[model samples]
Target: MTLLSYAKAMNRALADALEADPAVCVFGEDVGAGLAGLTLGLQQRFGAGRVVDVPLSEQAFTSAGIGAALNGMRPVIELQIPSLLFLVFEQLANQAHKFSLMTGGQARVPLTVVVPGSGSRSGWAGQHSDHPYGLFAHVGIKTLAPATPTDAYGLLSSAIRDDDPVVLFAPAGALGVREDVTAPLVPVPIGAARVHRAGSDVTVVAVGHLVHQALAVAEELAGEVSVEVLDPRTLYPLDRAALVESLGRTGRLVVVDDSNRFAGFAAEVLAVAAEECRLLAPPRRVTRPDGAVLPFALALDRALQPAAEQLRDAIRAVLK
Candidate 1:
């Protein structure tokens, strides 16, 4: 078994994909030098043509990836910052994602947009700290946020192989998580949720880095209330069946997400549970304040983001 950090695992997965598939190519700014660590050694393994370093135009390169995907090539575009997604939303949501349906399945855009270090990173402030996966999910794009190294590797591979446009958000909070991987790395199918901890009292659905917080809170509440930690690895094509099953066992739900409160990912989960599931008490969502702009100051930024304490309180409230 080998222990690998989430960041290094991503790099390894990119290298593995490049080596295994001749159709896979990557394009982004600073990818040649591996400035984000996720592309380290990838340019060396694959030539400069495959690991391309494009100009600073996000929209151009993003559309170019769609063009490449249409031509039977799988293109993985790396966005250095998470908020850059806003700059290419038209390319991803309107163009690459809709090509299949718009053209009646005549074209397939196998483009994977990987945003490493998404969400807050200390003093990166508002511009660099925005977590906009909810926007993609709302737009019907395949969206995934991997919480562990193994999931990071597996999900990235799956995203690259899928015949649709996919957005992979690698949270900054989860970048440090290390996992002991024993078996050979394989692709984890999109739209499957994993139950990290089983409990009968309350089912806590956590997205992205909040999965770790959910598990920790579950452990802390073991003596008082049983808490189940549900990690919805793929946010867009959520495994609703698994979530319904969990809600059936617990009869209570709490969602912990990194996005803002109003119309965020947490809001969608709550809406779905309210419509389909039978809950003993009102479900609660622990998320950032509405329209939060992550301040440059440390304390202010931390306050704006969701915390484990808030999740624990939400769980307790839901169980009560």
Candidate 2:
């Protein structure tokens, strides 16, 4: 048994993947230099031939990953910043994402895009701090936001193995997380929701770093309200069954997501529960204000993010 940090877990996964498959190659800005913490020392471990650093061209390099995948190579592309996803959206959504369907399963793009530090990084402002995971999920791209160090390793391993294009967002807030390893690291299924805490009252569905927040809130409200915390690791192929089962245990739902309220990931969970599950009360979502642009100030940035108190209040409201 060993202890591992989230960033180290990702690094280990990449190292294992590169070692397991000679066809696996990593290409992105500064990966060779290990500027992104997750790719630290990977270039040294694997030769420059496999960990080639590309020029600063998101669209071009993203398209290159698609091209590489179309061939026999498995390419892993790293975007240093989360918002850079927008720059490669056309390449991902139009080209790579469509190839499997457009080619009628004749071609597979086993491209994995890793966003090392996603979500409101303190004072990164509107452009860098944005977490646009919902956009990828909405467009049918396989999107995953891993909350724990173990899930970070497992999900990245799974994403690298999958034939379809996958986007992995490792939340900046959760990057510092460390986990105790009691069992061998293995691949976690893509579309699975993990129940962190079981409760009979309200179910709190959280994404990314918010899972930790929800669990903390659940513990705080242990005396009054029984809160069950659930983490939907994969956003696109949502585990509706697990969520429904959780709802069956607890008749109310509260979603606390780092994204915005309108058309956010939380909204989708609420919509799914409303359509499928029998809720005793209207589902509540604690998320950033509608179309929020996170300010550079610390207080302002923290205010825009969904807090545990907000989740607790939402849980209490739903319980009523």
Candidate 3:
């Protein structure tokens, strides 16, 4: 078995996609230099033509990716920081995302947008640190937030092959995860939920790096309550069936996410339970406080985000 870190798994996925498809190209700031850990050695492996580096303009480079996609080339644009997503939302949400529908299915923008370091990168400050997957999901853009090394490789492979614009947020906190792979890497379907732990007492839905925290909390509460940790790797096009089925067994739900509480992914999950699943008690969520602007101070930053204890409390609250 090979032990692969999350970043290394993504590197393998990009390398395989490049080798398998001539149409796949990666463009971004400092990508040729592999400034981001995930793109390490990609330029040398794929050549300057395919793994081209672009200028500092996020909007221009993002629009260029859309243009490349329109001309039948699949482009993967990497943004070094998550907050840059806000700078090019118009290009992504308005232009690239609407190409297929606007052209009546004649044009397909097979563009994959990658954010290698999403969420609090500790000292990145408020401007550089943010997790806005919910914003993209709100506009119907396909969003993926894989929690493990294996899922990182699989979901990325699937996103690159898809004929639509897909946003992949590799959580800064999840990048350190490593997995011993005894099997070959394969594409994981975009809209699937993985149950990390099976339980009959309560179901805990976690997003991105929060999945690991959820699992740990579940283990801590194993004797008192059986907690099922469900990771919705793909935030949008959510696996509602799996969620409802889990709720059938547990009758209680707790959602954990990094985004702000208001209109966040957590809110959507709770809405799903309210609409379709049978719940024995009110569903609760542990998330960043509403309208949270992460303070620069390390202590203040963590205070604004969700914690393991908060997740446990939320789980217990739901089970009551």
Candidate 2 matches the true fold with a TM-score of 0.99
**Candidate 2: worst 10 consecutive residues by lDDT?**
32-41
Task: Score every model by TM-score.
Answer: 0.99, 0.99, 0.99
lDDT tens digits, residues 1-320, model 2? 79899999999999999999998999899998887787788888888888989998888888888999999789999999998999999999999999999989999999999999999887999999989999999999999999999999999999999999999999999999999999999999999889989999999998998898888888888999989999999998999999999999999999988988889989899999999988999989899999999999989999888987788789889877
Candidate 3 segments exceeding 4 Å error: none
lDDT per residue (tens digit) for residues 191-260 in model 3: 9999999999999999999999999999999999999999999999899999999999999999999998
**Clashing pairs for predicted structure model 3, backbone only:** none
Model 1, 1-320: lDDT tens digits are 89989999899888888888999999999999999988998888788999999999999999899999999999999999999999999989888989999999999999999999999997999899999999999999999999999999999999988999999999999999999988998888999999999999999999989899889888988999999999999998989999999999999999999999999999999888989999999999899999999999989999999898898788889866
lDDT of 3 at 99: 86
Q: What's the candidate order when arranged by decreasing lDDT? A: 1, 3, 2
Comparing 1 with 2 on lDDT, the higher-scoring candidate is 1
lDDT over C-alpha atoms for residue 160 of model 3: 97
Show model 2 residue runs off by greater than 4 Å.
Answer: none
User: For residue 276, what is the lDDT in candidate 2?
Assistant: 94
